[model samples]
Target: MDIDLNTLRASIDAEVNRREFERLPARDDDSLPAAGLIDSVAAFEPIDLEGYLPEPPEEHQHIEPELVAELLPEGRFYNWLKRPPFARHLQRPRIYSLLTRASRLPGGARLSNFIYIMARGIAYRIPALARLLEQSKQWRYLPGRLAGFEYQANQGLYAHALAVQRNERYLLDRLQRLEQRLREQQAQAARTAGAPAAEAASPPAAMPADLYVDFEAHFRGSREEIRQRLAANIPRFKAVAALFSEPVLDLGCGRGEWLQLLQESGIAAVGVDSNPSMVQCCLDAGLQASVGDGLAYLQGLPDHSLAGLTAFHVIEHVPLDVLVRLIDEARRVVRPGGIVLFETPNPENLIVGACNFYTDPTHRNPLPPALVAFLLEARGFIRVEIERRHPADPKLLLQGQDDGLVQPLNRLLFGPQDYAAIGHAP
Candidate 1:
């Protein structure tokens, strides 16, 4: 058989337009012709309309009614109508019979055959009432077909909503890709235009600044929780404060919890962080803080300017070279007999080392307490010690275990979640 592509294309286009038009609400002025009205009335009878009515468009034919119910404006109302008293009344065979018969009548006759069948089946027990209903004239004009119309309307709305949602997602994805491409182009242009050779070399992937701040806020606990945790370190810092005259400095002072604790203890303190929002939070609380790279801020300070230096949960986020330089700067700035503390997630805890350490995308790698202590000693700090804090909950440990293997197993599974390396400036 010869194929006519133009005719097939025209037919498909017409069908698409027809379906789109059917999705629209009926106008008040539109009137059905006598013959069409008769056909419509017959279509609403107890007999199946599925064969008589046009099949739904391919895209909408498989849509589940339950999935689309919430997207419809009258969804709640429809759900309410399906419950108890209203549903019981609709289920009466007398009412359903009347609707089924009237739907076949002329002039304003509209009713759902599917609903009639459903109601008839439910009310089949009351044969006498059904017989009485067959003669009733009062319900002949009832607009029971509105239920069928509502179902069809809901399906159309759901299909339209799904299409719109897909379109929006596609546009958003495209916009993000465009933005990424634009940034890459700008970086390349800068590299070609007299930028430093080192900077032009392969740079590390950086998370968006705002996103990182929000990520930290979500994962790093509330300010009150952090303050409570840092309270344990107060005596340690207080001892160093008594020996030195200069103020303490906290690098990456997220929310300035340590700074606040030190100030409350009558020890002067200052803080520096790269996140502007965190610095703003500190400033709002009447704490002294500035927005800058922690190591860069340390480098700017004169030798023996600070009494103590602390960085809590900050080292894991930086490169090894940056961490070494930060330690070197801490030693140069902190006074003799003053302390330099570096707190980090303890990789000794098997769970923390293998899984939890990667929760923060910014974390470079887990650093062991012994490695930090060695680094501090190598940088000329004396009396280097490791303070294991925030141990795993006692309930997680193996109970009633006297065996040697059990103790070691418990330690491996439920050990200190974090640790701090404290080294004195010599």
Candidate 2:
């Protein structure tokens, strides 16, 4: 459908004219550029009010709330309300502003960025919500529609606003954990430095010569699920894996899935798994597979030997103390400017703790994105990005594989609920 530019223009003119009539500004009003009016109109034009479909029915809306937030007057919702159409730009920022200001100061840039990111999801969903608005057969009150939109928008806007404002507490708590972990790693490194060369030469934990048996036990019959997950991870893994331009290590590479994807993408890859049967299976597939402890395995390698390393869903299994050791060892082996891509199940996901969290008996706890980002930043990583993924339903998690794809079905019946954090070494 196409946007009814005329309707938009008429609405703007009516609103602007009404505002001017109520409180006519002097010559200053005439001097103001007409660009603001046009821009605002354009912002609202993209979203097809299906019930009020302009003409075009794009899958997504044109007015991005983030852009709207940036355009809104002085970033203050209160001021916009006193104005005309600007007051209804999006209800989220206003609610967030009120809640955040009242509780405490928000986390400067990070907090704002975080809220905007979540708000973007709400904006994307607006088209669907707008569709519902249009189809509300009995709902004929324009004022009621406007109010409903405003209330729904506000709900989306402030869904996580309070958390971002309160993120500072988590930040401080994470920093302390990092500092303490570093001290322990430093002490361990010192002791290892003094060990006899031969003692240090002992081989890292060995993988079983045959891994197929173990692969069968852990992965079992989920071949298609493995393929889908690997495909999803390939591009991300490649983003960092390609940097090394050399054979890289995939620590805790589950079932050698990622390694296979990397190899197909033409990056040389070796996988190390702690599960003996998994190592054997991968090796039988003609891949270089080893069963080993991740940290000890990294330490035994020559310093700066690796171009990159990947540890997906690996660190969560290690205790907090061992986590630093793993990162430290990764730093030592990877060349300067090398990349490390770490991903784990997001704790914020509804089923993560309740269902998927128990899939692996070894999983200690859900890894919150904020906590992961904090740990990496303290460890001297430069760029950090946190992402959330949709968790597979219990059918997929428990049955190893489901003939019916449960993730999409659950998202249809439910919604998304997974998270991840990515960071780079300085």
Candidate 3:
């Protein structure tokens, strides 16, 4: 199919313009500058949205009334689990319930625990109450669910006590073993100063690159699904096609989805990944890929040797130090005018930042658009623009939001779930 890059770009821009802070002052607007990087600000820092107010209520529209307290956002609750006391608890419902009951024992099962268990079982297992609970979102907030504030608060204390007990046992075991090993090693080192005592100074072992591959299908999606997803961003790829006269290098090419898109479009590209399984899968698909650390591969390349580079959904897995290094390496290896793109989950979207981002335990942090733009500029990447992708359906966004709060609420709740930071090497 012939690509209309302009039209696709316009479609993407239109969605962004609609959902972003356009009505607010330019300083608070969502669109970022492309010619230079935005200023370095922490991704999690509070933005200056001080004066931006929700629009006036619409006179003609009315939303179905569910009591205010019944609306429990799933993503918000997942982030709450990241807190100190709550974080320590066993996330499993059955385990938490068992532990809670055991903790209350004087000599036998406590009445509160018995009641809670029996009630939960009867409510969920019986046809009548089970159906009622199935119908009501509020029931999910019951004990062990969201509404168990007091129960969960007590669970926090129980979790802390258990954690302390386990940690003490582990520490005692490790310390005794460590002391013995250290004394033996110290004696050996003293006896062999000239015999090379460098074992203790060796760098830590490499993390198993395939550590999270088992969860890839859940988080990264199937190859066909990923390709269909990329199909929505044809303009983004078209921009890539226009900029590169040579093969593009795809970093962390999980499942070779983008590589497949590029090759099918007759665009030349090579994929690199640390996961051996991913690399082999790419090869089996008849796409070019290599197994190695992405940063190390970039560092090994000759200066200004490539025409373009892309790292989709890769940066979030890297430490900030290595992320900067990757940017620097890209600047060094890709020739002038070569395009550099990094697509990540858009944390500005509350649901994505708070919920989906955590599904991939490999993700280090969500890079806000401003911080990424700033980093690219810091490494001399120019024309750093961001494009929001995969917005929620307009119909869904409009429902119950006939009030002027639609746009503001959409920006807060239903904005694009992903973004691509595009720039060119200077």
Give the per-residue lDDT of model 2 (tens digit) for 1-426: 566778877876776566544443345555664433334433333333364555543223354544545533343433444355653544454444443343233533244544564565575579985576566644677678899899999988797787776797789767855864575467457657873221111112333324433533564337556566657756755665556665678887656777777778877788887766666667777778786776667767876787678777776776676676666666667676767777677656556657766665556677777877887777656577776665444454432267478654555333445455666555
Error of 2 at 111 (Å): 75
How many clashes show up per model?
A: 0, 20, 3
Q: What ranking of all candidate models by TM-score puts the best one first?
A: 1, 3, 2
Q: Looking at candidate 3, what is the lDDT of residue 38?
A: 35
Task: Give, for candidate 1, the lowest lDDT window spanning 10 residues.
Answer: 196-205
For each candidate, what is the lDDT? 0.72, 0.61, 0.68
The C-alpha local distance difference test score for the whole of candidate 1 amounts to: 0.72
Q: Write the per-residue lDDT of candidate 3 for residues 1-426, one digit (tens) a residue.
A: 344667666765665555443333365656755444433232223434333444444322332223111321223433353355654443444534443454354533344544566687768878988888777756555645745677787899999999999999899767754653464354346445643221111011243435555567766667677788777545655666687676789998877888888888777889888777778888999999987778667756776777788887888887786687677777778887778888899999998899988887667789999999998875667789998987765676745636786777888678898898988876
Candidate 1 Cα misplacement greater than 4 A, ranges? 1-205, 400-402
Give candidate 3's whole-model lDDT. 0.68
Q: How well does candidate 1 score on lDDT at residue 306?
A: 90
Instruction: Please tell me which predicted candidate would have the highest lDDT against the true structure.
Output: 1
Once all C-alphas are superposed, what RMSD does model 3 give against the true structure? 41.3
Against the correct fold, how does model 1 do in TM-score?
Answer: 0.51
